[model samples]
Target chain A: MAKKAFNPDIDAPEYKGKYSPYDIIKEGTIAVVVVALLTVVLAVLFSSPDEKAVTIKSWSNATPMDFAATAMTELDGSSGTATYGPPYNNAATGQQVGPLTLAKWMGINVNVNTANDFVVAPLSTLADQPALTSALTTFASASSSRRANWEANYSKGLSSGSFSNGVLQVAAANAGPLPEMLGALTAMARSGALDQALVTQKGFYTTDYTKPLLFMADGSFLANKAQVQHLSGDQWGMMNETGSYPGQAWLWLYTMWYQVPPFSTSWGANADALVWAFMMLLTLLLALTPWIPGLRSIPRKVKVYRLIWREHYKNM
Target chain B: MTTEIDRQWTTRLRKRVVETLPPDKLLPDTQPAYVASWIYVFGVTTLAALAIVILTGCVLAMKGPLWWHLSGTGHFVNSLHLWSVEIFFFAMVIHLWGKFFMAAWRGGRQLTWITGVVLFLTSVGAGFTGYVSQTNYDSQWISTQAKDGINATGGGAFFNVLNLGQMLMWHIVLLPLAAVALTAVHVIYVRIKGVVPPFEEGK
Candidate 1:
């Protein structure tokens, strides 16, 4: 009789050596019970972190001057939201990866007109006040240069301005109708109407939060809160939890890129795009490790499997 | 003479199933003695954690996001979901490390190894979307920060984290479904392939 050729895929040789009874259901049930008990105990002892959702109402209430100042920035088109480019607007060059213009490639899909969406549109809803109505009309009717001049002067005045009792008191300036419009906008925000207006689209669901977040991010208030919570980009914010709790440790590999040079310091480094692309490559390499010539050899070379199955080898 | 029924699609499928997984192998009551190791336990533990995660997630969905904020019971459920996810990743990483060291991909089981890695990648998406669905300051911050990276790759147009509706659906429906499907495939492959053998000094 001819002997069968060795087939590495076949496990008959290992199966022939020894076998032991294994109750998979019993093992699985015990694991489930242990995990469930652990989850319940942890849940009861340390509920979840439920930091309240930040809204225009909370933000304006917390720092009214910052709110007023941010409104000025929005009108002058100086805020980060105004010049973010692509999905929001096209005022400045966005981040890039190598020679690829990534932000430009996805050009303005969300079509956010920062001035219109962030300030004008939300404020326009409260047209009951004659002063606000007139301000809106005047601001809309002004020439581009005149509007720019008005916004610039008003923005300069805001540096020394103070907010009190729902009113923003700034030094007198040639600011068209900006101050009155902003005052009314502040009242609307204080009443929580601005938050509602920013999100309430023509739909049954009202969950879109782009405008409100953009408004908050342009000012120092939200970033300040984030820094206190250790959620800043430079702080490996993506991998952190709100308080001192466990975070997504699997994300360490992805977040580590942001700490290194080129991603961290290079002016043109589209850290987001570059990091995402690099992660994709890494994930692919991981998925194909068995086929990669050098990588596939590492497992055999390390000889760690010997330790894992040491008992089995000893028995043999 | 062999009949046409011999080549029928169902017959062929049944034959393939039997050839690949005989009943004794598919639902084996006995494992090779080499399977005796503590490291082997992590895989089942990860699966257990996943079950808890999914169960807690379902409870959260039933109550709605706002309800969870107001109710104490909701907080506990939310915590369970969070910690289960934490534990899931913890156990999964250990499982991955153990398997890698053991060269579990040997014996023509490369597909099983690849599926496991793919499942890990899918789970990351599921977890990130869960963060975006939290509807709190963290959600706000994460969505804004994550959008920059996604937009850089031109994914911002479709996968806008700021769109709560999109993220919620992905977290509760789409991504979870994919993760579960990938997991099922991974487990089925393991059943078909059987556990890898211990390495020896020579072939």
Candidate 2:
């Protein structure tokens, strides 16, 4: 077969009556300018980052007993996230399932023994202080039930408590060596010396103690309050901010899934697994949309693209 | 016989012209109309936001993560980068759903659709590593928590979340590269195929 002659003008039908390259460029430049201007306005007005930091010492000096009770509560299993199953610590009761079928496979891997990591370990560092060391040891050796009773009374007393001259005073009925022990712990935290104690064990240490460090931080009263302020976990949604600072408002969609029932109330690995599953489903749907029935036909139903290029269509 | 040969040549020429011209340049008889819609802007706007994110992110990487700790300008730049990411993901989600409603993946643009989906996933990974690199208390908590999840699902064996060194490498190197590459592929497909024409006129 012979080669056919090429005619650019004859083939380029779109250029017959449409806008030229320069015209398209001009329009595009305008669009870019408008977007850039809007971005600048938004940035200038909402220029804030969630960068607040709360240290152990800050809390120890400010809210002493809350710190002590937090330390003690970690020694108990009362901290909200203490028993949070899978990923953080291994508490079998913390695991969740739907009806049957491993519903979720992931389980606790962080494995934080709150009592040992938060309470006994930190106290061990202050062993040179005989009074604190002895009190911690006694508290450690006491029956679980006895310790629980004491903690319950102390925690209750805290509800009606007040701070005076840096000392936290509660009802005498809930008083004893516990308050003094707490005071010493508070001092240790304020001095910033407690971080090492909480992190490092008594003897030679080689293990990566990141888990213990996280546990201590999570179980800390200040950390809890900060998380609350930030609207973390179930109590709050993604839109709320801690203080006047802006948080991850972009996470509204991801966090919204958690607010609804079943997911909101689910426990342990199941909750995390469900979230992952929902995200996966969404991605897959977006990916395979061309093949899906109802979704694949929506472009025709709403026919607004015609309006965007209405002038061009009118001329055509 | 010569007239018949001329007609045959004319038919061949028309076929070649149709194949060589851009889809948008073809006559309405052969080119499908993309009946315009508001949803169309969502995808393009998302792409625009992502372009900003990549530009700002590159500047931030050049300055290094500690730049925020160094001076006021660096901190401002870091804040801008952070906000860019926040906006990028926000626009991305909107774009994803807009495409969903329009079923913009129909016709022969499946590759474009898949590339977009991959880009979204990679962006999430990039966002996560960005958080981890912050080295703040929130970073500390998310890293440890996410590590546990990753480990349970067997992702930990390869991606050690506890290794700040590894996390840093992934954040600055691996994930961003994947995101940019996937986004490029998505754009190429979109340009080559043009937008998928609207579904059949009535439904």
* Candidate 2 runs further than 4 Å off: A1-42, A93-104, A133-181, A196-236, A240-250, A262-276, A309-316, B1-48, B58-66, B90-102, B128-170, B198-203
* Local error of candidate 1 at residue A16 (angstroms): 4.2
* Cα lDDT of model 1 by residue, A88-107, tens digit: 77885676777888778877
* Model 1 lDDT tens row, B1-203: 76899889998899998998788776789998899899999999999999999999999999897778888888888999998998899899999999888777877788888989989988999999999899988888888788888878877767777889889999999988998898888887889878888765566
Error of 1 at B9 (Å): 4.2
- The collision pairs in model 1 are none
lDDT of 2 by residue, B1-203 (tens): 55676579788797675665554542222223433455555555666666666676677778876676666776666666666666677677777766655455654567887898888778877777777676555555556556544543435446656555567788878987888788767866766665554332222
Model 2 C-alpha lDDT per residue in residues A180-216, reported as the tens digit of each score? 5656766778787776665456455532435444544
RMSD of 1: 2.7
